[model samples]
Target: MASASRDEFHLIVPNESQSAEVKLGSDVTIPCHLSPEISAVDMEIRWFKETDCACLYKKKEVIEGRSYQGRTGLSTEELNKGNVSLNLREFKESDMGVYLCQVISEDRTEEIIIEVEERKDSDGQPVNQSSKIQGRQVHLILHESNRTWGENQRMKMEESALMTEFEVNYVKVLHQTIFKVFKNQGKKLEQTELQLKESKTDLERVLQQLETITEKFGLLENKKDLDMKEPQMQQIEKQLLQITKYTEEKQNQLEEKDTQLENMSKQISEKEKLLESTIKEMETSKQQLEALRQEQMRQQELLEKKEQLRISELNEKSKYLEETKSLLEEREGKIKSLEKEKDRLNEELQDKDKRLKDINAKLIQTVREVEKKQNQLQGKHTQLENMHKMLSEKMRRPENKELEASQPDEQETKSKLEK
Candidate 1:
C-alpha cells in the first residue's frame, strides 16, 4: 500500500529558486510537475495558501473560502498525465504571498510554493494614490522638495548682509593699492623723458657736423684736399651718392605710375562696354523669367480648374454609384422573389409527377382486373355454346325417330288395306 500510494501521488510547486513575481489583477501560471513514477489517478490534490494556511482546492473542486474562491484552477487532464501546473486568474494584492500545492497519496504528502507581487505604477508608486507621479502637477511638488537649506529665504538674507560688509572693505583696500602704483609709475615716466631728451640733443649735434662736411666737400675741387682727407671725403661722397640714387628711384616710380594710369583708362573704357552688354543680357533674362513666371501662373490656374472639374466629376460618379447600388439591390430582391416562385413551381411539378405516377399505377391495376374478368367471361361463353349445341342435337334426334316410326306404320296399313 505504501508503494501504491507512492505511485499515485506527487508534489507540484515552484522550488525556492524558481519563484517569480506577478502583478495584481493579472493572470499568472505556476508550473508544477509530478514525478514520472507516480500516477495521478484516484489521488487527491490540493492548493493551499501557505501564508494563511487555507485550502484552495481539493480533488479537482475549488474550496469555498474568501481567500481562494474563484481564483485557483489546475489542468486536470494534464494532471492525470503527471503535469501538475496551476492557473491563477484575477490575482489580488492580498495574494502577494507564498502558495503551496499539496498532493495526498495513500501514505505520503508533497508541497510546493508560488510567490505573488502587488502591481505598481510606471513611476514605482502605488496605483491607489490620488497625486500620482505621472500627473504633470506632481513635477512642481518634486521640484520644491529638491531645495536645500542654504538656498532658503533666511540663508539668503544672511549671505547678502555679509557680502555688503565685505565689499566696503574691499573698495578701501583697492583704492590704496591703485594710488601707490600710480605714484611709482609717475616717477618712472619722468626719468624716461629726461633720457629721451638727452639722446635727441646728441643726435642733433651729430647731424650738424655731417652737414658741415657735406658743404665743404661740395666746394672742394683740388687733389690736395682729397689726399689730406681723401677717406673722409670718400665717406661723404658715398652718403651723397645714396641720396641721389634714392631720388632717381622716386622719379622712375612716378614715370611708371603715369604709364599705369593710361593703361587703366583704356581698360575702364572696355569694361564700360562689357557692363552695358551685360546689362542688356540681364534685361533680356528678366523678361524671359517674367514670361516664364506668367506661364507658370496660367498653368497653375488651369490645373486648379482641372482639379475642380475632376472633383465635380467624382461627386457625380459617387451619386451615380449610389443610384446603381440601389438599383442592384432592387434587382437582387426581384431575383430572390423569382427564385422563390421557381422553387414553388418546381415543388408543384414534383407533386404532379408523383400524382401522375400514382394514377398510372392505379390505371395499370384496373386494366389488369378488366383483363382477368374478360378471360373468365371468355371461358363461360365457350361453356354456354357447348351446352346449347348438345341440347339442339338431342331435340333433333327425337324428331327424326318419331318420323321413321310413322312412316313404317303407314306403309304397313296401306299394305294391309290393299291386300
Candidate 2:
C-alpha cells in the first residue's frame, strides 16, 4: 500500500532519462534521490536486479539478499539528505542488467529502474556481438569473469558513518544544554554562599558591640554607687534599655541568615543530583558510539580483505583475457584459410561453366549441318518419286513417250535446283 502512495515526495533518477551504461568488471553508482530533498535517514532503501533482491536496507540495518555482499553499497551521508544511490564495486557479465531502487518511508514508498549495460569491446561493439567469419556467424567471448566475497561492506560503511553522526550530534546538544543549566545554578549558589558569609560577620560584630556596652554599663553602675547622684543613675538605665533592644534585633537577623543557608544547601543538592544523571546519560551515549566505531573498524578490515581478493581476481582475469585473445587469433587464421579455400572453389566452378558453354556451341553448329544434309536427301526422294510417276504415264500412252523423256529431264533438273 505504501508503494502505491505518492503523496508529498517521489524518488527520481537524476543522471539520465531512460538508462545508464556501466562497463563490465568496473565500478558504477546508480543515482536516486528524493524530489524535495528531505532526509532519508529513517527511510528504507532496497535495490533489486530484476526480480532478485540484490540489497535490502530496512529498520536501520541490512538483512537478507546477501547476493551482492561486499561489492555493493549506499551512502549514509547522502541518505541523510535523501540521495539513496546504489554503488556497484565491480561489474561482471551477469551484472549487466536491469536494477531497481526502492525507498520506503513512513508515509510513502517509491521505486526506480536503471538499465546497466556492459561496456563495448575495443572495436566499439559488445563482446557478445555476433561476428562474421568465412560468411558464418561467430559469437566471441573476450573478458574473464571474476568476483569477490564478503558481507555488504558498502552498507556497513554507510551505516556506521551515518548512525554515529546522529548519535554524536544528539549527545553534544544535550551536553551543552545541561552545562548551561548547571552554570546558571552554580552562579546563584555562589552568590547565596557569599551573602551567608557576610551575614555571619555582621552577627559576630553585633555580639562584640553588645559585650563592650555591657562592660561600660557595669563601670557606670560602680561610678553611680560611688557618686550617689540621680542624673547619673537615670543615664545608665536608659543606655541599658537601648543595648538590650539592639541585641534582640541582632539575634533575629542571625536566625534569618541560618534559614537562608539551609535552603541554599538544599537547592545545591538537587542540582548535583541532576548533574549526575546527565553525566551518566552522556557516558551511556559514549558507550554506544564506541560500539558503532568498533563495528565500523571491523567492517573496514573486511573491506581490506575484499580489496586483496579483488586484486588476485584481477590477475586471474588478465590471464583469462590473454588466453581468449590467443584463441581469437587462432580462429582468425582458420577463418582466413577457409576464405581462401572458398575462393579457389569458386574459380574452379567458373572454369567448368566456361568449358560447358563452348561444348554446347559446337554441338549446336554440327546439328545445323546435319539438318542441311537431311533436307537435301528429302528433295532427291521427291524428285525420284515424280520420275517414277512420269514413266508409268508414258507406258499408258506410247505416243507420249517423247513427252515423258522431256518430263524426266524436268524432274532431274528440278531436284538439282532444290539441292
Candidate 3:
C-alpha cells in the first residue's frame, strides 16, 4: 500500500475567539502564530473584517480601506517568527468587528477571529467625539474697546453660530458611523444565523446516527434471532464470495486493457514523432521555395528595367540618326550649289584674262607712235639755230661791205621783214 504525503503546514492561534478592547484613537495589536513555530516569511496573511470581508492586511502589505489607511501595519520581525499579527492604529467605533487572521501556507490554510471592541470614556460616552473635539481645538479670541464692545458681541455671537454648525456636522458624522456599525452587525448576525442552521442540521444527523447505532446494539444482544439468521448469513457469505471472484476477474481484464493501451500509446508517440519530422522537412522546403520565388521576382524586375533602358536608348539613337540623315541631305544640297558657283566663276576669270591681254597690246602700240613724233621736233630746232649763225658771219665781212651794203638794205629789209 502506498501512503500519500503532503507538506505539514499549520497555524496556532492562542485563542481562536480572542477578544480585545481599546479606547478610540488608541492602537491595538491582534495576535496569531504558526503551530510548529516555523518561519512564515513566505506565507500569505490576510486580516479582514469577518462581517463585511473588508481586507485590512495581506501578504506583508496592508490593504487599507478609507478608515484604515496609515493606520495598519505588520512587523517584519514578527512575521519572521511566524507571528502574522496585525497592529491597528487609531481605533474607531466603526473599526469594531470580528476580524479574521488567515494564514495561508504552501498546502494548508488556517484562520482565527479577533473581536475588537471600541472602549468608551469614563462617562460611558463614545470616546470618538471626545478625541475629535480635542484634536480640532476650535478657539475664537477678541480684542476690542467698549465702543466696539457691541460689535465684539456680534462677532462673538457669530463665532458661537459657527461652533454650533460644526457641532451639528460632527453629530451627523457620528450618526452615520453608528448606522454603519449597525449595518455591519446585522450582516454578521445573518451569517451567524446561517451557521446555527447548519449546526442544527449536523446535530440532528448525528442524533439519528446514534439512534441507529443503539438499535443495532439491541439487535446484536438477541441470541435467538442470530441463530435463526444462520442460513441467511451463509447464503450472504456465498454471494459475497461470488462478488469477490467477479471483482478479481474484472481487475485482471482491466490490467490487460491497461497493458494494451500502453502499447498503443507508444506506437502513437512514434507516429507523432515521424509526423513532426515530416512537417519540419516540409517547412524547410517551403522556405527554400519561397526564397527561390523571391529571387525570380527580383530577376524579372531587373529584366524589365533593362528592357525599358534599352528601349529608351534605341529611341535616342533613332532620333540622332534621323537628325544626322537630315544634316547629311542639307550638306549634299549645299555641296551641289557650291560646285555650280565654282564652275561659273572659273569661266568669268578666263574672260577677264583675255580682256587684259588686249589692253596691253594697245598701250604698247601708242608708246611707239609718241617716240617717233619726239624725234621730228628735235630736227626742226637744230635747223633754226644753223640759219642764225650764217647771218652773223656775213655781217662781219668789211671788204665786201659796199656790195653787201646795197644788198644789205635789201637783205636788211628782207631780214627785217623775215624777222
Task: Put down candidate 3 lDDT per residue, 1-419, tens digits, no spaces.
Answer: 11222145455556544434344567766666766566666776666553222333334544543225577767778766667777777755555556656676666777665555544568965445544431222111111111222343334333333333343354456557656755765575566556556555655665565457447645478877667766755665665566566556555655655665566566656755765675567557646755775687679789999999999999999999999999998998888888888878877777777777777777677667666756755654464455456556656667577456647555654664355
**For this target, which candidate reaches the highest TM-score against the unseen true structure?**
2
Q: Estimate each model's TM-score.
A: 0.27, 0.29, 0.27
Task: State the TM-score for model 2.
Answer: 0.29
Span of ten consecutive residues with least summed lDDT in model 3 = 137-146
User: Which of the two candidates, 2 or 3, achieves a greater lDDT against the reference?
Assistant: 2
In order, the Cα lDDT scores of the candidates are 0.56, 0.63, 0.57
**Which runs in model 2 stand beyond 4 Å of their true positions?**
1-234, 291-341, 362-419
Residue clash pairs of candidate 2: 25-91
Q: Write the per-residue lDDT of candidate 1 for residues 1-419, one digit (tens) a residue.
A: 12333545445433423433434466666666676444564566555444232333344543433345566666666755666666767754454455555566667766555544334579987445443222212111000011222223233333333333333344455556555655654565565455545545545555676778657765366666558776765765675565456545545654555565556555655655665576567557646865776787789889999999999999999999999999999999999999999999999999999999999999999889888878876776675566457555655777877577556655764574455
What residue runs in model 3 are displaced by over 4 Å at the alpha carbon? Answer: 1-284, 366-419
- lDDT string, candidate 2, 1-419, tens digits: 12332356777767444333434456767667787777777788877665556666666665334356577777777766777777777656566666667777776767666666544568987654544222322222212112222355434434443543444455566567667766765676676566656656655666666557657666566766446544554665565555556555555655665665567556656656765676567557756866786788889889998998998899899889999999999999999998999889889888878888887887787788778877877777686777768666665776567575667677776777666
TM for candidate 1 is: 0.27
Best by lDDT: 2
Candidate 1 local distance difference test against the native: 0.56
Tell me, what's the RMSD of every candidate? Answer: 32.8, 26.9, 32.5
Candidate 1 segments exceeding 4 Å error:
1-267, 287-338, 387-419
